[model samples]
Target: MGQPSQKPPSQKPPLQPWGRLLRFGGEESEPPVLLRRRELTIGRRRGCDLSFPGNKLISGDHCKIIVDEKSGQVSLEDTSTNGTVINKLKVVKKQTCPLQTGDVIYFVFRKNEPEHNVAYLYESLSEEHGLAQDSFEANKENMFHVTKDTSGAGQGDEPQFLPPLPTTQVCFEEPQPSTSTSDLFPRVATSSMEPPAGRAPPSSPDGEPNPNLHLLVTDQGGDTLSAPEGVRAVVEKPDRMEEQLTCCICQDLLYDCVSLQPCMHTFCAACYSGWMERSSLCPTCRCLVERICKNHILNNLVEAYLLQHPDKRRSEEDVQSMAARNKITQDMLQPKVRRSFSDEEDSLEDLLDLSDEDSESSDVSQPYIVCRQCPEYRRQVGQLFHYSGPGSEQRAMQAPGDTPSTSASVTPAQDYVCTLQGSHVICTCCFQPMPDRRAEREQDSRIAPQQCTVCLQPFCHLYWGCTRTGCLGCLAPFCELNLGDRCLDGVLNNNNYESDILKNYLATRGLTWKNVLADSLAALQRGVFLLTDYTVTGSTVLCYCCGLRSFRELTYQYRQNIPASELPVAVTSRPDCYWGRNCRTQVKAHHAMKFNHICEQTRFKN
Candidate 1:
């Protein structure tokens, strides 16, 4: 009995088709055709759903729009080399971004060449509602259908249905006679005349005819109405006080009116203040007003007028407040003095002198060695490597050596210090100090031992390979970790390999590195460095023979001449520089061997 009355199966709802109405030209231009497909492919290729052939800006498969029938959601995926921007924000390549109604999309050809780019306005539509379809079809007659010519030039031909031009006709109407007395005296009574019910007879106070009413209305005889004998009708000039009250600059009823001195021309306080920045002259007559002041009488008049027309007061106040905020921001952004090397040196020297005096005054005299690695030296117990010496002056004067003396009471140096002594090994990749052989050997047994050819310093290699690979062109040793899979041999074998590698590397860090590399390359080409023969490798700028160096070393080598302040600091910070002029001779020999050049002309001059 219960199974006898089973309900009929419920019917599923129809899937609503979603589409986009892509507008190409300006907003005032004719509407675009409504694309009703589930997926719309847009590109310059002939196979694309919407193709723009011969347009270098559009890639073969520029982008696609996908409409989800179930969710009624629309998304756009960019697939072009130039990139697609939505609402001024760049859409991620190969990633779908949700699109809303009235979203603006731009196909950027070249970032700097925005003029050549194309823009489109996106409008989402649903098949459930026929309004969008009807409107699109209505305007379809006016829209152009583009077709490629057999000769290969892409251009749109005129539509099939052309509307006929409308003809213009001329007609003239006969003049009509005037009926009202106010029409007879048009100029006098046009603005001030009252309604017929409000109109009253001219009042004769003290048995005297009103002169004002005589001027307003006149009979067919051209005489004043009910006037005293010999009293002629004189039209008093229309009150032009409102015209005088308007600001010359803003051309509106003045707010906080201020008058220029000598010229006495009135303007809105905010407008005049903004104008004074460019010119101190009156905008109307161009008269100089160096000593400008607010006209309080005119300001009162303007305030009275503003009270009657209360709409403009808020806007004027807002303008003044915005200007004040802008001024404050400008003041905040004023350029500040940057610290220079001389200032840093002076401060550092003062600090060192103070520390020396403190050590002389203290009961327990501690021996400190002036670090030859870094510029600034502050006397802290464990901050510097100190050794027992006869005096502080002698300790500072002692020759810079790598050997750790037995008499030396070694202390850990600052992180930036690179004296190349004790357990400090400079990393071949970053040119920064890493754990030395002792530290690496103590920490992990699996750590493979390696040495940098440039610095001749031993280090542990965990990633990539243990031994450094020499550049095939320059014969310079470079760490595999830093150089990635790139090598000079690969670059020489294939010309595009280096460019492809650089492009991939630049993509990882974003495109900003290209400009940095360009600037460094320019500097190198200009012979800014003592060692001119160098090349840009990824983010690092390396000397052709000596490999990578710290930024400080590069700066020192670029200058060629040492500054007095930097003399106390390490003169020979890099291993090549530490080896003296002989290092250049050896580098030339290696360059000659790798490049197959004669060493006679290429020998180190200095």
Candidate 2:
């Protein structure tokens, strides 16, 4: 319920008249409503203009015009009078509504029937009742309104307060009242340039009607207020702000942080310089770096967040948080952005294949998670290592070769911890406590694996059989049960054969040898490079035969070095052996074993 908007007239007046327009909301055809002397109580409803005067209903007091612009009903309540009646019913204002054409209302001032004065400007409704309308108005027709100068104005001529109605409403054709805002404060309805209901506003014949046209109002006294068109706009106050990223260097803010040319990656002035020093390209886009800018929207968000939390200490964590927050902001502004998934998830097929391969080996060759919750890294290669070189002496001390393993001899770098097992790794060599398996695990009680006596490092057995041998000197982990021939029980751990050379030579002349057991026997074989004074490859040949596995390394030595072309070829039953010079008798090629004894003691002699 509001009055129609008014446009400024071209005819000038030095000053506008003081007046307030009455707005009608109820229907006009129906007779105006009335009030009775009944609903009033002891306490008056504060802040309301209509109040009961000691058990009496009062109307036409401060109310002037009674008209209806809309079809709604209008009424009032007497909050103090107790004798008031609405249609012969004694109801409080809380119960009875205002008067209507068909409904009868009664009011009495002490002892008489209250008179209904539908007067427009009676003493009870105008300035005489201490009720005066204002004349102040802001000609909103002109977006930019300029008021008249107050200087040289005559006394008693100036209006007290002007109705600051946004007068620009007349420029638009659509009619709408500020119902929402009206409840809050007295509001002046504004017209919209939108087409009028049922029909559009009449346009000029030449089209583009009233271009450069503006609304201006002038009073008879030469006072003027003109509105500049299209100047007034809805100003939006910031509702909320989001942060995105931060500076890598100072961690303070990115100054002149221009978004990268290609990728739109934002960075500060000093940061880009530092980054360019190492590589000439944008940190984000990887584009060739030619120039940079200082003002970047992304970086601005970061700076703003850090600025708000002044007491917060900046750190890698803070930087990361800032980056995540800023990313959300950026994504909000620009959706359709791509994001990367976890490496494991992305290469799921490869990981599954690796798992299958490891399953065959009982997870021995499988990889373990060093720390499953390792913070996400924004850069590639999520880890760093200390290599052997200058400025790496600290790492050398930590992992010294001369020292034993971390558990016993050597140490490891702080950056790395063993991850062979959930929290422990087993060594295949010396079947002892291994450091490699002492990695973190999901389990509370971590079980570490033991070391192997063979490799000294942790291992998951790929081959079957017991490889835990006694000859650790050769780093073999197998017993006589696993190996076919030659029992290495004595020579592997501590030789327990004869202490003398000659005695050990004749000890086991020829029985099927699988394992050795005598410390005296090992002692007897000491320094006796040759088992017998038999004809050799012109002298003697040494064979370093590996007992743990089926492998052997044969080395042929001669007093004189001769080229292969000078040697004579000979045909023989064996294909792996060749003839040597001097001592004939073929000697079964370069070297062959002739099991013979000092006397007739050996039965399998040749």
Q: What are the Cα lDDT values of the candidates?
A: 0.40, 0.28
Query: How does model 2 score by TM-score?
Result: 0.16
Model 1 residue 75 CA deviation in Å: 0.4
lDDT of 2: 0.28
Error of 1 at 454 (Å): 40
Candidate 2 ranges beyond 4 A from true positions:
1-423, 426-481, 485-525, 529-606
Would you estimate the TM-scores of all the predictions? 0.20, 0.16
- Cα lDDT tens digits, model 2, 110-200, are 2221232111111112232122112111222231232222333332121111111233211111111211111111112232232223332
Clashes of each: 0, 85
